[model samples]
Target: MNYTLHQLQVFLKISQTLSITRAAEELNLTQPAVSIQLRNLQDQFDIPLTEVIGRRLYLTDFGREIALAAEKVLNEAYAINHRTLAHKGLLYGKLKVSVVSTGKYVMPYFLTEFMRQHEGIELVMDVTNRQKVVDSVANNEVDFALVSILPPHLNVARLDLMPNKLYLVGAGPTGQLREEAEPELLKKLPLIYREAGSGTRQMMESFLAAHQIVVKKRLELTSNEAVKQALLAGLGYSVMPLIGLKSELLNNDLQILPMAGLPLQTVWMLIWPKDKQFSPVAQAYLAYIRDHKDAIVQQHFGWYERFL
Candidate 1:
């Protein structure tokens, strides 16, 4: 009936990945070591926690519940350690943030100096899709969430960090379309899209709908990198944030299409639930960002001003 915290951590990772090999790789443990830990953890529970079907591992319903509980336990344990450090007047803790996929490009630049200055602080940034990012915010799983589009239903406080400009971009040279081409010309070309719940996809749909322009949907990809790869392959055009395309644009591997109503605009914001309480690390981050965002933007993203 006695399971250690290490066992819980191992079980939680296994549940997340659903593969012993993958879990072992992530945890930097050997496969046999991970299996022994999992076995020991499973022995403490009477019911089945995981099962193997064919070649794949799957968590049982009971395993899923246990994993959630394990996460809560681990979070509290970490909180206690962080709290003790803070009481000692040290800026030490894990700073958790969930960012939309494309936001990875922006959030890291803002974080660099803060992280450098506070060497004791640890960062756990999850780069995920819009829906998951919003879910993390709603669940209060992270101190902040970085997004270009604000969730309409969430009552949250936000800090505007920088401008997020999206453009209809295609692969190869700039002469693909005339400067005065009608917006309706989009109908003739295929369009690559982010998955449905992505902020980029949502903005793309809203922009097209507003212009009453319906284009052909050629492909749907889950990550910005995948979408960019598709664009480079000449698969189709897509509405993409310029932050992620800076290198591509400079190299002339991609070009912005000329059309009216171009450069869909949104601001990058760091948002948290309005009612949530902050940790010492989170408060320090907020203060740092508030005081330094202007200077950080000027240093890191001043080139983006040309697109605005």
Candidate 2:
């Protein structure tokens, strides 16, 4: 009860990042300052909030509960601030977005245009993998999320954003592999795979399952860029989203292998919890992207056609 919202804010940031250093950097505060705020905040509680184990930081059970409560408090506070600005006829607020890694290719364009139109808006974007994005959605940690696969259990409002086409890509001459999309041929080739919990990896698994194929998992990469680099080095083939491969495809650093039932088509969706109230800025962005999806896609992604 003695803690200020500032303390809660700092604690929440630390909880989200699991790094006092990162939380301090994000909040534009010194590490000592952040530590002081955390110390002051924890003084009011009888139980320890967090623990450091083997150079890694973790929230205790009580810390996790308090972090969740802090999020709700901050969200409501922001909502009030939004209303106050609206009363003054001002468009000033923060927009928090959590996006899956592949969505990094598309979200910046949308956010750039939106921020350009509203100079007072603050944007906080987290580009994480699908699992983290899903956790954000589940925990109501972000205003919106951009992802390829929608979680079936969450009650959410989904707006279809754009098509996400995944291709089986590799380095080397285009015809080095057999022309046919045969399971036997693909199984023999070295495959570079995204780490587990990736939406792309899950989709690739389903695609391979449909074909009854099992590939040689030569490398497991943590990021799309890593996978792309491995492909360029001829380390292995991978199923990659076309959005992530536009430049490489154009430069002939990578080639999409010809195959039956390839280029698996999925749709990107913008989602927020159905029950959550949106701030004026969040509502405006939702409407703007919905209204301008085609133009946005054409403007940002028109180059895709020349390569396709």
Candidate 3:
């Protein structure tokens, strides 16, 4: 059976998302276009690769197997192109990284110069919750994963990028509460939170549990931006990363509540599975990050040091 690389590419996206609409959106193709490609790819195989049940798409066992094969094929294809570019003294290929949601703020600063220099590189940065980022690393779906909290079970190598400082913050008009009154204040105030499986949420939970402080959970939001909006609307306070709150903090839109054990700290890390082979683009990224992380942090995040 013969299938074009584009068909395989389209099928791989479909397999990942399990939705024609989502695959189309991600691929920047029309839904009809995606469907046509999928149908064409399906025609090459006699057996069903996908099945629709209860209006939801599910890949057949054969589909899952083929998807894996398709990924290998695509990676090799990318490798071939990258190798040719490398011989011409240029880096080329896809650099896929999955980052925990709040990491979006940090990753871009590190990426800007590298991406600008390597114009031939294709960058795909997936911003999702901690669990998804971890899964991406575990499955080798991405070249690297950026996270604050490392998964204890995964055998991985990491490069520490910078400090991730989390503080309990609320809509501003700074209050003059003493450190001793902080826990009692938390008990009385409604707490906004990131959704479960978020690194921020995990850190917040652990902080509360350790201090034996139980907060009234007012709202749970999915993304950092959502949580920030909830804070701006004076909905509630949350433990938020300082990296994402620079403007808010400076403008007094949010105020960090100084508690006894305030500003819980973790290191932002670029992690990869220990045994995974790095692509040319991935290796170039690692090298660029290593050479420039210090300068990047000082340039982009120097204001952060004051909070520390």
Per-candidate TM-score against the hidden true structure: 0.78, 0.74, 0.75
List, residue by residue over 1-308, the lDDT tens digit for candidate 1: 79988999999999989999989988889999999999999998899999989988999999999999999999888788778867887799889999999998999998999999987798998888788999999989999999999899899999999889898888953464847466777788888989988889998999888879877789999989999999999998888999998888878898887778888899999999998899889999999999999999999988777666
Q: Following a full C-alpha superposition, what root-mean-square deviation does model 2 have from the true structure?
A: 5.8
Per-model lDDT: 0.90, 0.88, 0.90
lDDT of the structure predicted as candidate 3: 0.90
The clash number for model 1 is: 0
Runs of candidate 1 with Cα error greater than 4 angstroms are: 1-12, 24-53, 57-88, 174-176
> Model 3 over residues 93-166: C-alpha lDDT tens digits?
78999999899999999898899998779989999888889999999999999999989899999999999999
Please give the RMSD to the true structure for each candidate, in Å.
Answer: 4.6, 5.8, 4.9
Ranking by TM-score: 1, 3, 2
Candidate number of the best lDDT? 3
lDDT of 1: 0.90
Q: What lDDT is reached at residue 22 by model 3? A: 99
Kindly indicate the candidate among 1 and 2 with the higher lDDT.
1
Per-candidate clashes come to 0, 0, 0
